[model samples]
Target: MTTDPPPEPTGAPAPTSTARGARLAFRRWRRTRPFWAALWTGTGGFVIFFLPMAPLGQILQVGVGGIAGMSGGVVLMAMALLILLLPGQRHTAGVIAVIAGVASFPLSNLGGLFVGMALSVLGGSMAFAWLPEKPARRRGGRGLLRRTRSAAETPVPPVSVGSGSP
Candidate 1:
């Protein structure tokens, strides 16, 4: 026997169960802000931060390196959060992240073995390059190449004839 689906309440909208719905929602959320930049920067920061804790021989014992790495990583991570929280300040965050990533190299286990440095730099670049969406100017589904009637309706003034030799 086939089981019947449960009935929904009269006024409530049915919940979406499909993964596609989730994906669409995520896409919409991503388009509105610098989501990828934040993710990459944060990941890089975490890598940099965790490397000091990892038991790599002689890696963490270097004088001041461990502290430097942790500090740089924390800065990068904070920049990522700032980018996500205040998109208008993304440029500032991006610049700070890049500087921190570069500084981490000599300070933090070679910038978490170079992985964290690369990721943070890349994320910062992406954030700096990101642009906000512009509102569409066209109405009535007009194509960019299509000319408006107003332009075509305007009459070109006839060229006036003048004596060549005065």
Candidate 2:
């Protein structure tokens, strides 16, 4: 024989407001990080770009590529900055760094090899560091994450037969 499920009561107050507030707060925090990262990266990149393409380029044979190269540097800076600032999955900071580092070589002078590498590493490091880490367990693996599965994947348990009467 089949058993009927208990009726879910309606007209109850929802606790969704707290969840909404938490979501909003997380979103704001998420947005703020990359904002700062982008700003710093862009500023540092432009400084590197201008130093070579405008002034130092005249003296150093390394900076001879002109606007295209400088533009490339800007692009690299933007990418690197984004990688660091954003919260999502981006293991590509290394790739972005490679491009920026290589391109920065001619623009910043051969001496720039050192500087460019440093900047590239800095960009990657900043992104890695900027990402939020989950707090450690207060009671040794007793956190919510330990007991829960994603809603989509959770299995529903089966019910048994009658309990009291034979």
Instruction: Report lDDT (Cα) of residue 119, candidate 1.
Output: 95
lDDT of 2 by residue, 39-107 (tens): 444554655556555465454554345554566567767765556555463446545645665566655
The prediction achieving the highest lDDT against the true structure is: 1
Q: What's each prediction's clash count?
A: 0, 3
lDDT of 1 by residue, 1-166 (tens): 9999999688755566466788899888788788999999999999999988746565556657787788899999999999888989999999999999988999987898999999999999889989988876866565533555578776799976895756
Badly placed stretches (over 4 Å) of model 1 are: 1-12, 17-23, 54-61, 140-166
Off by over 4 Å in 2: 1-44, 55-64, 111-113, 125-131, 136-166
Query: Model 1 residue 71 lDDT?
Result: 85
